[model samples]
Target chain A: MATAATSDIKWWAGGRSPFNMEYGKLMMWYFLMSDAFTFGAFLISYGTIRFSQNYWPDPNHVFNAFPFAGHANLPLAFVSLMTFILIISSVTMVLAVHAGHHMDRKGVIKWMIWTIVGGIAFLSCQAWEWTHLITGHHPVLIDGVVQEIGTTVSRNPWGPDVTGMMHDGMQVTKTGPVAFGGYFFGITGFHGFHVLSGVVINIIMLIMTLNGTFDRRGHYQMIEKAGLYWHFVDLVWVFVFLCFYLI
Target chain B: MQHSSNTHSPEVTFHHAPGDSASTIKKIVRTTVILSVITLIELALGFGIYMLHKNPDPSHALILFIKGVIVILSLLKAFYIVGVFMHLGDEVKNMIMTIVVPLMLFIWFIAAFLWDGNAWRNLRNTDAGHRPAKQEQVTKPVDAKKPGGIE
Candidate 1:
């Protein structure tokens, strides 16, 4: 009868009542849902600002990096690599969870380490990309002339003297308060901050797992919880890629 | 809950479990090949639009059509991941829907905002020089050599 019930009990039916899972998985899912909303709000705000602006620069033009050759239209590559890394990490995570089911501590640890490494590599690449963008590697076309976009008014769409650089790396001089640079920094910076946070969380999990915390608990729920967060991170990146890179 | 050693029921079996290796590697490879072909088609269409369309400003209608295709492709991929890899395919309907439906809404909300916003920007580009309600007398003629509505 119990075996029959096991096969028959629907997940949502069980969702109503507490089952074998601890509060950890539920709380993790709740946290992921909240994080999803945060990313959604950011994307919506990005759309609003991009729409309001008259002349948005092409994403392809702004993000071009030729792999090992020269900086050239390869914005998609870093993001795509990030996507693959996250997906591969998630696969490893699932394998960890499977190992947990069998009580294979060593197997779980091996996979968890791999996932953590992928997360760190992804964060590093994102940091490099963010620095390049902030430094103005790609200049915008102003008034039909291409010029350096940083604090120097080498050239711009609004004609000469429209923009200038400030002493600090933070401030950029442009035609008005709502120049393109402001919007670009605001959107990309917000997403980059999320990646940084995700990296920190992954590191924390890695340290805990290494210390045999998860092994002692005898519950793979932590692995599943980490998977949920990791998957959410990857999902947000997909949208970020589309909105910031392809769009 | 009994913690049975028997594999008779296989309580929490993974689709890609490592070695009795229930799923063949060939199956995973086949799925990849099929998905890659679809992605190639999308790439071809994207390049075709960029090359053939003389009008840089795609009308709202065209944007909407392209947006529809993008959403469909994305949904298909999402479902494949959830079903095949997540092993939610053979699960109950409510569970499957629970995983899939919210994603659809999420994609729709973001795409709608992006499409509507880009349309407004393109329209503004047509009247780039004139402020909507600000009336300023033109003491000097507008610069003819400068491209006014260029983006």
Candidate 2:
């Protein structure tokens, strides 16, 4: 019955859409929507494995180190800084899009440069973190022997000391379960790849802007599309931060 | 330089002018400031909880409440980014729903998977038919090492 009454609305009558969006932009939105699901699945699996364990490593212990802090016990401070950088980059991307809307070519270029710099800064920070995690901190004396601890698919230094019985007077520290490090590397590595690709795309867009390709077309729809992709990347990081760092 | 050859070209239509209004610029600045402030608050709350909590191992309820708050705040940031930065807020209702309604399935998928995975874990641990000897061997060492047992 309600459907019959709604037939009077001309836009719903379906000859043309009232949503004034281009075909390309709408398609990009649909693509991002699907990509979001891929990230969602990764995070959900991480949560499942983490909660099912008897003793999961606490996030505070795992992510305490920050750049130049010299091993200060700052829980999640580095990631919080990363989050701020990504958000600021998103802001710059949007400002570029806004400038595009106004046909301000120089504004677009400037803001896009800032966005690219932000992406590079973020990637460098991630590199530092990965280096620190892979190499690990100072060695600890376990059962009368100094053992160097680090992160790997099978073990991590953060969790309970899973060192098993000494064989021939050699101590064996078992560390955490295999799944913890596996998920940590897999999820964050995937996200880092996304950031890398976003940087490359932004560079291409920046070059085209300089050459006046968009100006010749008399529209900056390309910039808008790039902004959508950049913002989606930022959105995914928000959830990743919660899954890996906070929860 | 090619005006003579381009004289017959069709006139191009532009969607926006060469510059934005002052009010539009102001709005952009305001949104940026708001986003930065929210992020700062989230950082403060997270570190504050860890620093101020009396117990080294906080109560389960307390941790759960703090986790809930953090999740809500992060979602708020997502909302602002999608709505303002992506320009979806000004879009028509039908267009907005086209992106939003389908995404709800993502949350549903996560919830369903977590529940099923938890059940599998429980079954694997308790049901002898599922694991029998292997499960016993794997859990025995860890169970023995748990607190309140001989270290």
Candidate 3:
């Protein structure tokens, strides 16, 4: 009694996907893949410029300052702490997703709250680092005149003097090259913006969870999507840390 | 006790309770701990090398080796995050390929651009790439007669 059309229909032509993934989740992965390219380009550019220069800033000397350390040389200590915090936050985010799958609303909320806290903490550390860098002075001697310098789009306290010139009695003092600051600010600023956006998205997800939105739907796929974004941000940081801090 | 006929309908269904087994939770904790430990080791190695070298100029091979280790550690961390945390490991093979193949192109793009950028850097300092321009001094004379009789 079955119709020929119904009996002969192909699985590929059906509404269900053979890949066993929802359309939204697959799209999220694709988007993250593209975003990874953007980060990759920025990092590759950094590597190119760094190798091209005669001297690049030593990350150890540049990032030595630590909170309340009174200028003690604890090279890369602060940034390492920041990295740990971000990694822990990534752990919490994954835990939240796991909880979501189990339909444990309370567990999801708890872990998500921890992840948001970690994001804010990381941002705060970055703000402090930037403020310290901007406000600190670097003394440079040009033409027998002592001039103080700070970070700018074209110059960085971390790099050799880019604007120094020789004269009849001119003296030159250099900190770091101009390209270092340009690339540092450009790359880190871009990453910071991503973290900010991630935080905002997490906040929205938190509010929705509180309102029982996902509970009503009897699923928490939304948490999984947000976790994907949060994890991507963390993933980018791994590369950033290697390029900017370790290398 | 007597059961109602409606309660015995074949269409009746119940939702499965949501949660993970204890072993899964343990596995998540183990992964997190491993990641943290790796990060710690990286920090120690980085700082230790810097401290031990002391000189601004260290041997090129040593520096290159250290950098290689750092990059390897970073890639490992990235792998763990993407594989387990992102649940890509659990997805079907085709779905995984759908994401991984395009990412291979991303890596190629970085490699290609970096090689080209290095070539540009070398060319930038050459005579054919750079030409100096003449300029006039624009500073005002300090000995102008009207300036308080030259102070």
Give the number of the best model, judged by DockQ.
3
Candidate 1, residues A132-212, lDDT tens digits: the string is: 655653243445454455422232222222345423342232332234455455555666676567667766766777788
Q: For all the predictions, what are the DockQ values?
A: 0.14, 0.22, 0.23
Model 3 clash pairs? Answer: A159-A175, A159-A176, A159-A177, A160-A175, A160-A176, A160-A177
- The candidate scoring highest on TM-score is 3
All candidates in order of TM-score, best leading: 3, 2, 1
Q: Which is the leading candidate under lDDT?
A: 3
lDDT of 3 by residue, A1-247 (tens): 1222333434356565556456677788999998998888888888877766667777887788998998688898999989989999998998898788777889999999999999999999999888777776666664467567777667665545446454334333565678887788788889999999999999999999999998887678789899999999999998899899887
Model 3 C-alpha lDDT per residue in residues B1-151, reported as the tens digit of each score: 1122112222212112223457667878888988898888888878866775687677878777887898889889998899888878866567799888887886677678768777766776676467565587687777656756566
* DockQ of prediction 3: 0.23
How much DockQ does model 1 earn?
A: 0.14
CA RMSD of all predictions:
11.4, 11.1, 11.4
Could you estimate the TM-score for every candidate? 0.66, 0.80, 0.82
Superposed on the true chain A, the predicted chain A of model 3 yields a TM-score of 0.88
| Tens digit of per-residue lDDT, candidate 2, span B1-151 | 2222112222211112223467677877788788788777767766756664547676778777877888898899899889888878866568899989998897788778778777767765786435546444445444656787766
Worst 10 residues of 2 chain B by lDDT: B5-14
